[model samples]
Target: MTGTTRYLPPGRLSRAINRVVAALTRRGLSLWGSRILSVAGRTTGIMRSTPVNVLAFDDEQYLVAARGNTQWVRNLRAVGRGKLAVGRREQWFTAVEVLDDTRLPVLRAYLRRWSWEVGAFFDGVTADASDDELRAAADKHPVFRIVPTSTPEDRG
Candidate 1:
């Protein structure tokens, strides 16, 4: 569970849930701090979007790829920026990857907040897992600090 290359593709249920979540966020609803994450596709250059949970910790926001190196994670790493949208509001931001060594706290906090939804991907790791355990699981999950570059703007 400590490899950056690991990725567990979404199952049918997961995919369906993502679509519903994205739709909800687009309609001005947030299901547990969810938002629509839009990023230019590394290959197509067209914006591809998916639903994501925004983790607020230590007064900063972070995006953690709990399912491992999924498409959106790879795209964000390649582009280094993207837009987060909730209904008509869009915020542009640049992302910086968090190194594996420093991910313990964020990983623990994120798990504490999202374990019900994303826990399977982390195997048996939990919010109360030892620092070493969480650290070992960190590399399998890519984390990015969201540095917003634009004020939230009205889409209209």
Candidate 2:
């Protein structure tokens, strides 16, 4: 969980693209369920924002990092909570890391939806992969279910 997870750092092009997507999403334009995820830094406690794709399954919303154990994922783990914003709407939620065995459905659904954008980070594992394969990849990619809370960040 510490040194084993794979992380794909965004390059200049990806950063620029993320900036655009984050800006648009902040203004209420969600491109294919995209949202700006804001979480506090693990050490600095400063807020960091990044674009993420939300997966909805079984009446619950989830945040899955295609790139394993990313900064946002680590930060959220440290803080235990985060905010998801789309346009002017902000929703605060508690994040609970899904265990390896329970992550298959969400991981599979996420790939099926956003694989074109993040498939490369999964080491060739697509939505079509077998459940065992997805489960194997779960250790690298962390999945968190977003449990909405009536917190200060909530704008609804």
Candidate 3:
């Protein structure tokens, strides 16, 4: 109920659901299998591109940050800026790590709104976590939010 428990990675069932949904949505998709793509630079200030399944999006985008300490996250941190492309839409936003322990409550609130996606990750487990613990793990893996600069390109 606390510590890493709150911040645990997606459970098997949830992962399965995500996999299925991704496959279905991605059928015949051309760009990247994952609608959410994380692009970072290879060299300093250069842009490196990688596609990722967007866990959820809010006023800020939510990424699982599962592959902790991976090169993409490292590169994003180095540049402090990047682009997240979803479908035919693209946006440039400044990346920032949310570390405030107080933000866990808010994070939980946000995740609840994304229950379909977030719940699947937890295999429909009661997505419960204390602000303190969620904050701690978030600090470890850290959900990087691309604070939107302008309205996401009109999808309509």
Candidate 4:
């Protein structure tokens, strides 16, 4: 995917909501497939956690940056791996950034699945939006394919 350096950051209200959802997912109460993503910070190496909407399309799992190039996206790019936690269960996985040209289908599926929550960030594009529209908006969103890693060292 293209660098989301110019994507908008989450506002205070959105941040607050994410915190709440994250807490719930961490406690194992998944809200509409939500999960708490934990990745090591690029600078501090401290584990940074955020609530994310995990999308399952076809037979693979994905993580989409609905809020654009946020901290987690940057951290994921740096670390190349992370964990998805729901309550007590955690799944370790390495991430591959999707190419810009391949993002439309994934973006469409994501919007279709979570539009009520993330549609606004797409500048009015909905799940029903045409491919051209979705393609036009693809660069603004960053998507990563999640590959399950058996062990922490497996990420390498």
Candidate 5:
């Protein structure tokens, strides 16, 4: 919780699984509520994508980095915006990183929803974890509030 953030890069097998999931999500198929997150690389300016679980809470959507301080996190920090695609549906949105103190509920909700898939990244914390435990782990995970950007279609 109050210790260093944990970062576990995808292994070769994990990368391959992600690629497959991304392909499906891009083509309009969401595997267990997944989306392909596309953001521009900070250094190269090229589009980078990875599969992510989108969390909806209290009429607000969020993107949580379960793995902690990942490439997408850095990229989002740089650009403050990105696109999420599921199938042919795409949404552009600006991101605001949630503050550390406010991240507990979001983190708890995320674990409750996605722990089956990403629980290992949270050290031993579970969705049933106490508030204090969750607060402690807040520094390791980054949560972003998603604000949809106005697009031409929406404007018209």
Candidate 6:
């Protein structure tokens, strides 16, 4: 593959997996599942939401930008923050957009840790935008790392 070309597409498979996992988790197979969180666009002020696979790693909640350059990313960027309601739990959090340089290492690490789950991305089976494309996306859509301003009570 050329340096400009992507080894994989955006996280299409990851999203599909998220959907399935959420369904299974909701069915009581797992304790927690992903959810569709809403946030308002900074420019238009329109409310938009998307389902995201979330994890509580290192005390901070994180969400992956599966679609890469999807509108939800833009919404997070515009508002510079957002809220998430997963299962019966609801809370608001501030967003910090993760740049590629910062994101790559983290994503790599996450991929390593969650390899079986995120296999599609690592195996090049997932559709992924190019690095340049993702860069443009970060500039356009942006990955908003949600960090809660207050302590979210454990609803588990």
lDDT of 5 by residue, 1-156 (tens): 134446789889888999999888888989877999999999998999999999988889999898898889988988888988998888889898997767788888899888988898889999888888887777788889999988855311
Candidate 6 local lDDT, residue 103: 58
The sequence of per-residue lDDT tens digits that candidate 4 reaches over residues 1-156 is 375575677789988998899888978999988999999999999999988999999899999998788889899989999999999998999999997667788898999899999988889998888888888787778899999999757955
Local accuracy of candidate 1 as per-residue lDDT tens digits, 69-147: 9999988988889999899998889888998577789999999999999999999999999999898888899999998
Candidate 4 overall lDDT versus native: 0.88
What's the residue-level lDDT of 26 in candidate 3? 43
Candidate 4 residue 7 C-alpha distance from true site, Å:
3.1
Once fitted onto the true fold, the runs of candidate 2 whose alpha carbons sit more than 4 angstroms away are 1-3, 152-156
Ranked candidates, highest lDDT first: 1, 4, 2, 5, 6, 3
Across residues 39-105, which tens digit of lDDT does each residue of candidate 3 receive? Answer: 5565855566554544444454555454345566766667666666644566677767655563465
Top-TM-score candidate index: 4
Better of 1 and 3 by TM-score: 1
Residue 91 lDDT (model 3): 63
Select the stronger candidate by TM-score from 4 and 5. 4
Q: Tell me how candidate 5 scores on lDDT.
A: 0.85
User: Mind sharing the TM-score for model 4?
Assistant: 0.93
Best by lDDT: 1
How big is the positional error of residue 145 in model 6, measured in Å on the Cα after superposition? 2.5
Which stretches of candidate 5 lie above 4 Å from their native place? 1-5, 152-156
* C-alpha TM-score for every candidate: 0.92, 0.92, 0.54, 0.93, 0.90, 0.57
lDDT of every model, 2 decimals: 0.89, 0.87, 0.52, 0.88, 0.85, 0.54
- The lDDT of model 1 is 0.89
Candidate 3 yields a Cα-based lDDT of 0.52
RMSD of 6: 7.5
Compare candidates 3 and 4 on TM-score and give the better one: 4
